[model samples]
Target: MDAPVRFDTKVALVVRADLAVWQKLNVAAFLATGIAAAAPDALGEAYVDGAGRRYGRMLGQPMLIFTADRDQLRAVRDAALERGLTLVPYVAAMFTTGHDAANRAAFQAEDPDTPDLVGLALRGPKKAVDKTVKGLALHG
Candidate 1:
């Protein structure tokens, strides 16, 4: 049997609990992209089947997804930031924008101190990430 793998860093996504099912999925997908971009090392080697068909790579480590209320989402963002960890946020405005530029503009317009965050993605040291997400339940 293959030995277990461990990661020193952790990736997490926290989505607004009040969002619709579709919205939750959208937020998760978008935020995951940000994590992948920020941490290239997070990705694992591509796969090949028995017939030699190749498949795209995926995260080397498991990503934990958590659901939180609007207030909790803000708190989580703040906590991560306070720890000097980088955060990739998806504001409510991004949903209405179609392109990357518009999405960025919408993000810039929000209050930096308290954004209307629908979701957030973060990658950092395991302990820091764990402390940042403490008390949060896993998303189903």
Candidate 2:
């Protein structure tokens, strides 16, 4: 037999019961739990080829899915859907570009502004020269 107490501390105790259980979780586990806890209001936006294709911003339990090509995009989307997650396609380039706006913009225009050779390789070096003759015209 148990007696019901009319006290505000009852609710606090009930909520805090799981506190110790959660405190032992690692950083990755904590982050995953936090995401799951906040999934009710999280959003998933897709950027396709530098354009916003689909805006599933209101969807709950949102997750970002990105790829470099159409085939890879299809595979990623299917895998996500199979895992009970929403499928949204976002271009990897655009997502990465968000980190460095200036360099991305310059690269998009075929102009190499960043000192990163890899970035130049990814975006290509065609835009740096107006014409093939001018581009091929070597400077000594």
Per-residue lDDT tens digits for candidate 2, residues 1-140, read 78753221100000111123332122123233334444433333543545646543332332221112233323323333344432112222332353446534644654222211110001012222111112121111
Compared to the true structure, candidate 2 yields what TM-score? 0.20
Candidate that scores best on lDDT: 1
Write model 1 residue lDDT over 3-79, tens digit each, in one string.
99888988999999999999999999999998898888789999999999999998888889999999899889989
Which TM-score value belongs to model 1? Answer: 0.96
Q: CA RMSD for every model?
A: 0.9, 24.2
State each model's CA lDDT, in order. Answer: 0.93, 0.26
Q: What does the lDDT come to for candidate 2?
A: 0.26
Screening candidate 1 with a backbone cut-off below 3 angstroms (N, C-alpha, C), the clashing residue pairs are: none
Error of 2 at 36 (Å): 14
Cα deviation of 100 in candidate 1 (Å)? 1.1
Which is the leading candidate under TM-score? 1
For model 2, give the 10-residue run with minimal summed lDDT: 8-17
